[model samples]
Target: MTVVGFRSSIGTWGCAIGLIGLTLCWPAITPVSPAVALADEPAAAETPPDQPENDGSTETDSQETPSTGRTLEDAPTLERQVLTELESAPHWPARALAAIRLERFDCAPTRDRLIEFVQHDPDWRVRANAIRSLAERSIEQGEGWFEEEAEPRVIRTALRYGYEVDAGRVHRGVRFLLRSNRLDERLLGAEIAAASGKDDLVADATDTVRSVILRMDRAQAGLLSPRLSAMTGVRGLFSRQDWMRWFRENGRRVELAETRRDPPNPHPPPAGERSFLAELNVDAFARFESYVQQWPELRIDLVFALDCTGSMTPVFSRTQSIISDTMLFLQDITESPRFGLVAFRDVDQEFVTRPFRLTQDAEEIMLQTWLQEAVHGGRQSESVLAALHDSYAMSWREHVERLVILIGDGPPHRGEGGACIRLAERARTRGGIRTQVVEPINAPVRDFKEIAEAGGGRLWTLDDYVLILAELLGLERSDDIDQAFMAFIRHYTELLR
Candidate 1:
């Protein structure tokens, strides 16, 4: 079999380069490139409504016909070719790419085809891409479509896109995700519900909501409490029992105040009203102090599986610093912290993977030595799957918070048919190891997202390591940390604009 490498501008992230029939290389973040000519099809008499308006200048045109030696007259022909590919492309990747390309077209036919893909596409990747494109264009497919979608990834895409086409659909989707067994999905549901400020979104699922609250650790509960309080019109409650009791007692009668103005004073101040605020403040302070006292007893085991291939040379030093800083931070919060390392390269490299078993803080020096000794030399695709398998087999502490952070810049060798995702699922189900994937800049995200979802963790960028570490460790509550995280997100949003 002959392998060919070709780059095609798929979506907003950047171009995807196909290598060895499986690998996809995501270039660094940049503006969406002009559409490439896929095929030589007959021109249509009238231009589609979604087609970009053609101007004389090459810079302003959205099509790459001029560079390809084709004329601007072939713009409609190119649209037909892309639409045809979306409908009948034999390979799933081609179909997925076509769906991404259709984002530039917002006509009825483009929307109808994308909606069909969302409803009936055999591949989940294709369906996810289609739904994302629709959401990006802000074209709603009405109700009952996204609400009934069963795949967690597709539902997550809708949630990330804030697909509020219909309130009922969004409510149903949130309910479904809240009930999901995956921790990441449930967390996302809680975040969306709290952010949406829709008090009735989880009205009937009080028990499920309480369970989610009960599962959260101290830091998580602290960060989420104020927002949830604002949404539920309740304050100073921490435990699940307190929340449920309040819901049962005053949930239906209490309505969120419509105005910010102070309520009218009672003719005669109620008894104990003078001390109520003081008492609540004292109770909240006591609860936080108790959590702080228990922090030292928490146990955690973390393994870092890094792709030590030549391509990662540019960002490898930064990766090392992130890992080191995380370890130092963990030591401050927990008395018992175990660390491990797995450095991986390609099959033909000096070594495919060098793994260091989970060791206590006393042996941190050895782990750092192994990490620094890794040499970067290999093909584009490294032995990522092999490294994950090794990391899962490490001597993880039983009953501790087990975590694996996989940092890489490309896909696994030959893709391995999603073997890494399967391994992550097995580790989560049998070993309770939550796997997080950290991509540097423009790494391909589809495979990493799937693996993280399977392992009940979220995919994060390299810049988010501090926040990720803080969340996983349930570190001390600090307003600065929260503000920094939100600011980073806003920065990314501005870049998208």
Candidate 2:
């Protein structure tokens, strides 16, 4: 389909603060000339409430519009302007807005650029918008183009994006995606089931997807809250168990021959609310805190975000040693303390991020196994943003103080004005995941400091970070672990000095 006319306007878009940027892009089509419209000109069409932009605030205010007074007026110009912004825009909001606006532009290059964004953009918002935009455009343009031009990966990405855009057209896609054993794909299916707002459809989800829904963290719980909340008149439900029970009891309602005609609820619960999930979480956490204060011990959910890049090779063995010892210490001192790990390297590497589920492995063997087996080889910068995003997603037990200790030697890609900092803020404000950065004596410290502060965590040298964690957990430093930590502190201090 060739577009004869279109208009671009800087409009307000929803920027999700903490969760991987998930924004809805709906471009308003207005007939206009092939000339670029200046910012001062009034927009012909009203902007959709879900326009994607990066403002770093967790609040989803519909009234928030882009500061760019300009709008797109033609396909050729839109393609040029959007592509230019995606390539060179200094700020994420510009890139994201470019991506959201790209949806309405119809051209072969636009399609290709959207696919590129899906594959390569470091920022998740750009990639998501590109996927959603491509899916919407393909649906509108007809099957001929997709049948002839779309690749398998593109089709799969489109199917997932279709769930967010138009679920009605992607039933077969959802079913196909559900059959995949990959956790990410299954997650796509589960999200589709929840987004569909049809309980029978959700109930029919494969066991894998069902299990995922049953295992969702509070953030994931928030995703399924809209229809569930509206259905039960219960606004504050959290945890996979509560949702599973509700689904099992109400699954039959969605199976009726008559389709439910409930108006879509605009406000799906936000994950960052002070009363996240249930009132029970608040009460339980309050009691847990009181109990902890009385007991004089720390109950923490600790995750290690280790940098496993080529530059970090020198410390790989030592890092593993540190993790093994720390886990053992936690097991002995804290009451069933949970431990998790995220090992990361830069983009275009063997892997960007490798995440392990939270566990209390008393043996402390498997944690060591992963630490030893994972190789780090790539560019100097790494996927710190990806690691932070995964850290936010971990299912920390309720009432446990969530802490992520990021141990890395390289700066995060897109460190300046990137989504990583905002995401860190999101993790702190929404998920209550405090982060601490442990920079290698040789690694860049400025980025680590900024990101750690943004996430409400601290930045320290490797040795100091280890000691701080130990002290907080009330672990005695009189042991071999403490000696090893102290030795490193002296070595780094002397070496750096």
Candidate 1: regions farther than 4 A off: 1-291, 362-378, 415-417, 475-481, 484-497
Best by lDDT: 1
* TM values, all candidates: 0.39, 0.36
- Model 1: number of clashes? 0
Off by over 4 Å in 2: 1-297, 362-378, 415-417, 474-497
lDDT per residue for candidate 1 within 60-121, as digits (tens), equals: 12222112221223335545544464458544544654565455443455656677787678
> Which residue pairs overlap in candidate 2's backbone?
7-72, 8-71, 8-72, 9-71, 12-65, 13-51, 39-69, 39-70
For all candidates in order, the CA lDDT equals 0.54, 0.49
How much is the lDDT of residue 205 in candidate 2? 47
TM-score of 1: 0.39
Q: Please, what are the lDDT tens digits per residue for candidate 2 over residues 1-497?
A: 11211123333222222111212222232111111111121224555788965332222222222222222333245345434744555443335444544554444445555555655565444554565554444422222223211122233333334323233333544454465443334444444444455566556543544455555543334333332343245444433445676668877232212212232232222222211111112233233223223222557888888777777755654455556545544453356677787777767777878787787653333323233433556555678888888877888888888888888776777544368778888888988888777876555654778778987866777567567655455434455435433433332221111
